[model samples]
Target: MENVSVLEERKDFILYKQNGCSGNGMRCDANSVSGAVSQRACVYCGARVVLNPITDAFHIVHGPIGCASYTWDIRGSLSSGEDLYRNSFSTDLRESDIIFGGEKRLTAAIEEIATKHQPKLIFVYATCIVGVIGDDVDAVCKTMSKKYQIRVIPVKSPGFSGNKSVGYKMACNAIMELIKSEKPAKRKGVNILGDFNLAGEMWIIKDYLKRIGISVISGFTGDSNYENLLESPAATLNVVQCAGSSTYLANRMEEEMGIPFIKVSFFGIEDTTSSLIRIAEALQDEEARQKAIAFTKEETSKITPLVERYKKNLTGKKAAIYVGGGFKAISLIRQFDFLGVETVVVGTQTGKKEDYDIIESLVSKDTVILDDANPAELEKFMKEKQADILVGGVKERPLAYKLGIAFCDHNHERKHPLSGFDGMINFVKEINGSINNPVWKYMEESL
Candidate 1:
């Protein structure tokens, strides 16, 4: 809750003890301050990360090669069927193409991919260069779609358009365009939204749903394929996991298709249990609801002992959290609390007012809550708080180590699943190992 001096322009973006209680909300969902070296990604990167997980979709970045290269395999999304989404394709537009317009080159790229791969769907991303050059990507997509007799969707994601949140909306709009249909008869199933299946987390959640007698019609993008998405309209309800990326899609489906959505988080045991029960209740399935309760009880009993053992060593340690979405930050706060560790500092990239409100209520009054924080801000807060560990994405890993604080990877590129009952164990084990690692002691001794 202590106040720290920051750049004059970034003062409103950071929250601490005085302002945290003033009922003055944190500033978010806005463009990053100039020259702050903000950690937030661009609009094109956001759109690519959200849509590239569809197993069977062909993705083309209609701009320079660097845009495509940076976002290649952006999400650690595993596929059960097709691997086409893993390849980063681009028109490789050059000075000549930009000057003359890259429409023809884009058309050729789509034609080549369609001719060789014969894909069912394709997404063309417009980067800043394409936006500047006045390329009509939408018209090109329509012509190519008719020519190939396939769905060629243009993602209107220019990097200069807005921040990552805008890109999430753009990707959601593209998905809505791809899956729109005459109302289909509803079935006894749910569509999982917002989870990118990083580290096979989607598979883990699907298995739990199956055990509870609930069928998953589709995953929003993670491990989902063309067929899965095409059948999504038939689902009875939607359970949104990553609200940051998929909430807009859910809202569109509800408005256009009459499928209601409920936000759910599967990160920690507490949320996973509640979300499963809520899904069953939303479907009016009493039998499945009872099954969900039984599973929660069973899983909690099985995992609580192991977590308690780790807590013996971890209790009273403090943590700093900086993640992509508000839901993940909220879940991590609870997870750390369960382990008897206190979260002293927390921030999010795209969290809204409501998300921050929940976070504010959950953490202690002294806890620092920030939005769209840059590396300098994170380091200052973590150091001031004397955090024992920092839970964040790849971007923050080096920062944590350079400050001699233990680090945990809780982002998309992680190789381990961090959802459901199984994930609770993995998360606790990682936290215990990272915090108790011997290297920190050696560094201190040498210092």
Candidate 2:
């Protein structure tokens, strides 16, 4: 690791080799720099990631067409029932509307869509210009809710207000408004949080919970509908998977409804086994706990041989991770460990200080830990670390290729589910395919 001078403008944004270089923890959860080409998305992107999986909600972007178009069905969250959430609706505000007021058009768009679709819930997202023009999105949503007698939620996600983490809090606030259960019936169930059910990952986890005699009352938004979200208060506990997006929601639920929450990850065999046992023990169900232990033994026996085969081929490989949140990055480090891979360089877009603390504690002393890293910083760190593979989202794939490094897609666009027993297998297969490719041999010699 090398010490690089930070620009006066970006002094608070970039950190230099914080893994073992400094006693102070890395700074995180701040607004991205103006011209840094940061991989972090806008506030609206954060809102959409958490709320767009409502299977039957009419998600209308209350701004220009670009915002709606860019986020239309962006996630791979599948629906078990209605596919209404897949469609992107926009008010399509133009230059004239921006100069004037777009509230009237927004109201009309809501009325038109509600009449045609007859959806039970609607989510209106405000964009950058909507924030600039000071549109009364909340007032319009209130009026529309009264007019249609359906829940019309307003997500105040102005692009420049803060980072994506701000948008996640805003989305949680909107959901709190929709909860109508005052005295929910107590049941032996749990609410799944943070997972967006990408490629049916939530379904896989739900099935496992069912086998352990626990019912899943609702998912945060993944494959979840309006009715399921309304029933969330009835559950006894909350099992949070993606802590970055759902921790706020879980904390609010505990405060408002008196339901406790526990953070868990099902990304690797070690995590998945522990999470199942933890969930069962939290409920004090002796039968469920025994079943969970039995389930882990069976599943591990089936998956370990496949993982061991891949581990033999992938021993001592070094990996670099750059993802949206800290939980995924932490899980990836463990997932890589199963295959004998070392995470040399790791960074996150909106990871909190606590997440960075755990990340710093887990990796080797020489590994690089950074926050809100730009493309130039990522390139420099990966090359300096001599990373064999880069595990990141779509944006970093091209950069890895240009450097003759292997790349893996661990973001929302990936069709394969990377969760539970099935996900562990997928994780190893993806790493083996990327790092052990035949073309790398030729490229190495040519370089």
Candidate 1: tens digits of C-alpha lDDT, residues 16-120: 644335577788889988989898999998898999999989899999999989998867788888888889999999999988999999999999998998999
lDDT of the candidates, in the order given: 0.91, 0.89
Model 1 TM-score on a 0 to 1 scale: 0.98
